[model samples]
Target: MKAILAAVLGLALALPAAAGVTIDAFKTDSGLTVWHVEETSIPFVALELRFKGGASLDAEGKRGAVNLMTALIEEGAGSLDARAFAKARDGLAASFSYSVSDDTLSVSARFLSENRAEALALLRESLTAPRFDQDAVDRVRAQVVSGIRSDEKDPNAMARQAFDLRVYGAHPYGSDKSGTLDSVTALTREDILAAFRSTVARDRLYISVVGDISRQELGPVLDTLLADLPETGAPLPPVAAPAFDGQTVVIPFETPQSVAMFGQPGIPFDHPDYFAAYLLNVVLGGGGFESRLMQEVREKRGLTYGVYSYLVGKDGADVWLGSVQSANNRIHEAMEVIKAEWARMQTEGVTEKELKDAKLYLTGAYPLRFDGNGPIADILVGMQIEDMGTDYIATRNDRVNAVTLEQINRVARDYLKPEQLSFTVVGQPKGL
Candidate 1:
């Protein structure tokens, strides 16, 4: 009886560990990667398509062209106007959305299996046959231009933009993903069409479908939707790291609060130290309320409501940034505290307790990312785009768990030099 009770207790703890999700991976005939996860609890399905060339592919003067093209895709395509295209999805009770980032453009749709055919047809039209009508272009351009003007008045936006420029210089990632007002206005319909043809090629595409779908069922659907796209394997240009000219830029604004942004060049996604840097960032600032930055800058001194830092990993370059907003009078003091924390992380390194807790939170919380098919499919697509291996899901926690205190200390010293960093303040500072 004693032996049986012990066996049962051991099995109970092992159950949660064994209950993790499994994502099956495969590829299409045309070389597009596919990741699938099936859930029988509901009759819903989601398909996501990601293209390699995103905002980073924009031409020198055409900063916002990729974003504009993404917005215009659904405006008119394949025997449907913008309203008709929307009504088609609404009539089927399906959800469709498109988004652009520095590295990729994603189009996703979620709907019942019964409506997958019609929903996918609409997606195909949006991808291959966008009309780029004048009305839609003008409307979205106005909105974007208005947004640029709005950012001019926003101190936080100003600070972030200034920081990127200071760190990245002439690199594409250094520029705002959204083009400036002048560049956006200069973009013609021809430019949008040309960008689409060049960037959205089938060869540069990866598709992931999850929830109540199999490879056999999805293969023909994908073929039909993407059949018309050209197979031009236009390779992306190599993105070189931009030189960081360490300087402090102060943008004078009259707001009661000041937004402080400090930055330096960091690691790209494919770097060997990527995981180590990611772990270090969480301990430093990415852990939110549990992070040292928040503990020292906010909780300890009450300098601001929140202070945090992150690495913006891009296709060519990455940026390490720390930002906060506080009273105008407290801006300089807040900077001092942030600088102190950065310098300390570089010199003294993290405690065993700090490193242990960071690993615990990072590793233990990994399962939350795969709670459903939608998020799992999203991660799979992103992994494929970043050239991460399929086993990345299975091995991710182990990688985080393997980061040693020595590794953290080395990365902290190498990447977190406060004196070599650039500073941007977008409100009235006490001294300036």
Candidate 2:
């Protein structure tokens, strides 16, 4: 569960790059819409449900409510305590994973086709009638607090915290979804209930199912599992305007290796030049060691072990971000090389060969995402959340292939401003 769930966590936006598959879209009698794929090859089913406004829906001053609530949902349900719930779920050999990010709460379920009814019934209980007993709440809260405390002493986490603070300021996106110790310690059972009622409602739900499930068969199941939720949820947070200034901030930490996070504003998923920018990023840093950032900073200069950049498109904002770590004495050199690569990409953009290579890897890698039912289900759900049409899976590579060299260069020049890159470094260093 941990391994597979962690893999999917990295792929929330992975539909743009999935293997070929078909999607069936329908709305249940209860006004619940679901996108499904009829794959009868395997006698198993994978269902993914994404509810909008995740931890961001936490009430003001009750920052970690949604996160803690999500954790507790699988702890106990209806008449079952934690032990009973786990026993029931494992008895059926079913799997359920609940996770929350800044934008959404995701529920992923996998179970044998024969056990579908029982598994979904148990899941329904968890969703609509989570016990949230004081004991369960205390246990999960303690785990969350422990993780938060551990992050305080982590250099990479410290850099990320500093970077988010500078970019998002007072916006919900700026803070950890898990909340501070004081806030989590102050949370009450009522706060957890409020977060649940505000988020696990029908109006915020998006679902996708795959494997041995027919559209007709799935419609009723959808209502059974979801119809009881509230018809609406709390309003989403306002759009964030990320602030990416061209300055370096260094936080002194007692670590041998310094970690640095850098970023600038970026385009959204729907922007016309988005595909072009995506390809350009592959050339810049996202292509692993083949990327210019890796080549210039690691392979050539030996300044850092690795340096990579990626485009992050969240519900409220989009930004170009990157990270690197090096000996305190060499982190400055790594930063200099990264900035130089950034400027070079902006001015020269990607060459024809670089663009061609990026297209090959991105197109080739997308199909692997359809290796099984679970991946297909997750991809389809992400596509729905991003509002991509059903045809996206079939014609995705076409879109990637259509990004011409001219388009890539134009997007690079317009979007990648080296002068605007902000650096947040954690750990003691000899020089700036």
Q: Against the correct fold, how does model 1 do in TM-score?
A: 0.91
- Top candidate on lDDT is 2
- Candidate 2 stretches with Cα past 4 Å from truth are 1-20
Candidate 2's C-alpha lDDT? 0.90
Encode model 1's per-residue lDDT on 350-421: one tens digit a residue.
888888888888888877666555666687788878878877878887888788888888888888867777
Q: Write the per-residue lDDT of candidate 2 for residues 51-124, one digit (tens) a residue.
A: 99999999999999999999999999999999999999988778999999999999999887778899999999
**Looking at model 2, which ten-residue stretch has the lowest summed lDDT?**
8-17
Report lDDT (CA) for all predictions: 0.79, 0.90
In angstroms, how far off is 266's CA in candidate 2?
0.8
lDDT at position 268, candidate 2: 90
| Candidate 1: segments with Cα more than 4 A from true spot | 1-20, 233-235
